[model samples]
Target: MTEALATLSRAYRMRVYPTRDQARLLAQLVGASRHVWNWSLAKRTSAYRERGERLNWVSLSREFTEYRRDPERPWLATLPREPFNQVLRDQERAFANFFAKRAAYPRFERRGGRASMRFTFDQRRQQVRDTGGRWATVDLPSLGSLKLRRTEALNGRLRSITLSRDSAGRWHGAITADGISRPAIHVPELDAVGLDAGLRDLLVIADGHGTRRVPAPKALASKQARLRRYQRQQSRQIAAQMRAQGLDPTKPCPKGVRLGSSNRRRKTQQQIGRLHAQVADLRRDALHQASAAVVREAQVIGIEDLAVKAMSRGMGRKAFRRSVADAALGELRRQLTYKAGWRGRTLVAVNRFYPSSKTCGACGAIHAALKLKERRWACPACGTEHDRDENAARNLRTEALRLIAASSPATPRSGESDARGEAAAAVGRTGPAGLSTSANREPTVAGSGAKADRRQRQSRPRKTRTDRVAVGSG
Candidate 1:
């Protein structure tokens, strides 16, 4: 097993910029590919409707070739078979995934706008230039002698290359390879860290070392503003174009507008899309770095599996949604899992129900109530003050460590696990009414009967002063 594991490899992708002619060829390839995809999809849909099951790519390609020979479909002959084959393969995968419940029904690819193509290499001869300098002799099919700017070092056997165009009118090639090794693990002491993800701060890390705040990049906000401005400009231009064309400018335009008439609007839309893509790329890069840092430094990393969907159902839903989208907490978790696995580090997840925020870190006592508005609080039991975010981070770290200890062969000698078990049992003794208390009561007297009494009094109706006065007068 160890030998097989040692033989196992890794894969990485690097973006490469191509020359102008290469970009044009890429665009043409993408258009032809999309055209092939649409035509094949239409034929397959028709066939499936008439004769159960869709036709295979080979058969379809043969038929397409015959159709191309016909004078009526000369445009089909002009289409590149390589891209057509690629599209057919993509459609096949899409259909297979849809049937497997892995993805939704395949959507038709848009033609000509942002062209792309894929290249696959055998296990051997996968090596390509990566000198960070322009290549003079690299060969690309149908587009020869293309200059490429290498962004990152390539490792292992090259498997595939996918070339795509950005909305910024830039061309990029993604080189996929195999046989890469996992990054070296930086094993630290069994110190665990908890992260609280938020809008104001990207991540709040808490550990035995102390609390630290990692703020989101200012560039994210700036790029978002730029994207919005571009989008607004594009919208106005599109509206004006619609008005000039004797169409209802307010109504949504159809999928492909008259090319020449809406050229400028289309260009603006592309610019806006490019800006969005840039922002997304920036966020993804940041997330990778942050996740890698945590995975490298911590022996065990614990984070909340926050139900972002449920949390978004609030008064300020847009803001919450934006926060969730910006943080990409789920993506962070994903990266941590895979990266940790590679490094043989532990990635622990605290239960969503865990009251990390409400729980006092200094004491084991859980706060009965903690609102989002409260940024800081003092633990009544321990008399320990805490920044709310920091408190949550501490709680997460402790809980994660506890979880890891319980799951591992090495149990703590202090019987903390036994105490925790007893505490959990005690929680169960309080019943359903008790659950509400923890979710709603104040931090000071969380589990006390006084809280229950106060809640009851609060729920009950009070007699009016006028009624009391009338009774006294009578």
Candidate 2:
């Protein structure tokens, strides 16, 4: 049997530079859409509570259409209604997710946060056009052509584009497209490597050649002092201003007394936002480069399915948790997942409990009592010394290769020995039979696409990213 040609919906985030008037209009557009969402939500709540009526997106949109068309509300009539339609569609999905227990109930869109609007591609308006080179132009539903910049030219059919305003007052657009060409496959299938993620070392990669380590980039730590100073200065400025207004600095302000804003305060806040964004950009840039390097070289990449949240909770020190978060371990894996899929490489996720650290790479010896502090140790069965991270990486590569072989169309897995299925659902929890560190039942064979049953939702064969990294640096 032949495998189907795979396709992906890739999204790109580009910087958008809008004129003064366009910026004001963009703000109005997002504000109007927000108003509609809040109003529709209120209407739905009232209908359900008072008249026992349920209102979906269609019904809410119909009412909004009539409401906006009234001569009394010229403010709503001037703006294009297409973006609001997307808002309604999003609201509908939100409600559906809530009912299905996938998300919380839809909330009202408020002011003074990240303002955004979604516009579907319509050829004339709401289209993305590449002028030439790295520069492009985007036309939202109502906003005229806005200057845009990206590393690569827009290719294939433009699906829909979403524009947003961040706290720093910068404009950005996320353009979704279809049929875009992915990176070419150049490596052999046997070129597999294992990646171990940690705070001490960003990544310890093991391959046929040897083991290599990448140092961790503690981006936040580098700027921690600056961030703390800014925060303290902001706090002190606020308290001083409040005290000047004859209000208690320590206690909450009275409802009637409003603390006014100043250019100084606003400037301080924006500076903080810029710093935070810089740190994030630095971290993300590093992750992208690392993942790209890994994906470009290897055909099969094995990685641990790290439970970062659980791992963070186990750490007693705030600094430890902060370090774990700044490392962006999960983000690295996410990048690897999509990049590998795009580049025609295979990314295999080893179960977290796989004892990669405890198991010996040279000999299959399990050191149950291995401590976390022991960075280097010798195998009990064979006296070969090993670096903990390097050993773990080698083990992961072996497990990933085994799983891939077992899941192959030629393997014909059956009965109780499906290594791929076990890698997906079991194997890590327990050791060998009697010597098992943890005991558990055998997992069922995991198929490509699972459908929803009575209790749980369907499982997907693979989880791939819909967004691709920028072709060049931000």
Candidate 3:
């Protein structure tokens, strides 16, 4: 096991920026690979329906090899043997993944765009040498020497290499290697921090160190506007071109222009695609950095598991939902999980039901009613004045610590159980289900109880008048 671990530890990925000629070769490889994949998929789907039996990679490879021997199947001649074999393997893996419920039914790969090819590292044939520059030189079969940017030093035995091109026409090499596994850090005993994720304030982190606000980048909004404008312009150009070609503008634009058409529309479309890519890159970079920082600093992090899908209701009216989606809270969580694993930090998810807002952090008192507009409130229980967001942050940290301490195997020290019990009690009181009954329990006139209740119910805002009447009658 240790020997296997040692072998695995040495592998790492090196992204190579290929030259123009190399980029063209990559495109050919991708196209060939996708063609093979689609052909195999069609064959397999037909066979599965007809024969009621599954085809393995070895059988498919053998079949393709025989098919390629026929001069009549001219397209088969264009397919590279290595990429063809890879496509068969990819298909088999896709089927396996489908059975495991990891993914949906595999789709046919399209040709002529972003072609990817894979090559295994053969120690005897391939040599990896440090160039003393930014990238290291790796010898590839037939393709010869390729320089890849070494983001990190290569560690273990190289297993396989996959070459892919992004939409931006950049080549990337993903190298899988074997090496020793680093020991994961055990959940540490340190101050817990609460993060309030929002659009305006990207993150409101509150801990013993005090509250700090991390605002969203102003550039993101600006870039989005530019992207939208460019996309609209591209659409207009395509429509104009269609009109010039005597084609219906309302219908889908024909692939490739008429024989004598200008290239203006095609160039405009490319410009729009580049702008879209730029915006995505900026957003992704910002998310990675922000998530990394959070994982590095906090021992235990607590964040609201907001149901973004549900929150997106009424999104048509306001563009706020779009901005929130761009914030990518889900992506933040994903990065934080892996980053925490790499750095040995703990990320605790607080329940969506947890009322960090309604509960007073200082006195542990639950407010009978707290609205979104009540940003500043004075806690009746402790006389502590609180800013809603900052208060929520504090409560999150407190709740997270309480949860961790309870879940720990070690017995609580003197007074620890008592403090935990009080925190738990408070949580039960302020939680969503717990507070639902509070509205019904509001004061009523003693003698005129029915009428008072009717008046109170009518005064309370309801989604419909029928609902108000139903509650009033009850």
RMSD to the true structure for each prediction, in A, is 26.9, 25.6, 26.2
Which residue runs of candidate 1 sit more than 4 Å off their true CA positions?
Answer: 1-20, 64-80, 112-114, 122-127, 131-138, 192-207, 211-474
The C-alpha TM-scores of every prediction are 0.40, 0.42, 0.39
Clashes of each: 1, 0, 14
Task: Answer with 1 or 3, whichever has the higher lDDT.
Answer: 3
lDDT of 1 by residue, 38-113 (tens): 8888888888888887677778878767766778766656554555666778888887887799999777776545
| Model 1 TM-score (2 dp) | 0.40
Candidate with more favorable, higher lDDT: 2 or 3:
2
Q: Can you write out model 2's per-residue Cα lDDT over 31-68, one digit (the tens) per residue?
A: 89888889888998898789998788877888988999
lDDT (CA) per prediction = 0.60, 0.68, 0.62
Q: What TM-score does structure 3 among the candidates reach? A: 0.39
Which 10-residue window in model 1 sums to the lowest lDDT?
465-474
User: What is the Cα-based lDDT of residue 413 in candidate 2?
Assistant: 35
- In model 3, which regions exceed 4 Å deviation? 1-14, 19-21, 72-80, 100-102, 112-114, 123-126, 183-474
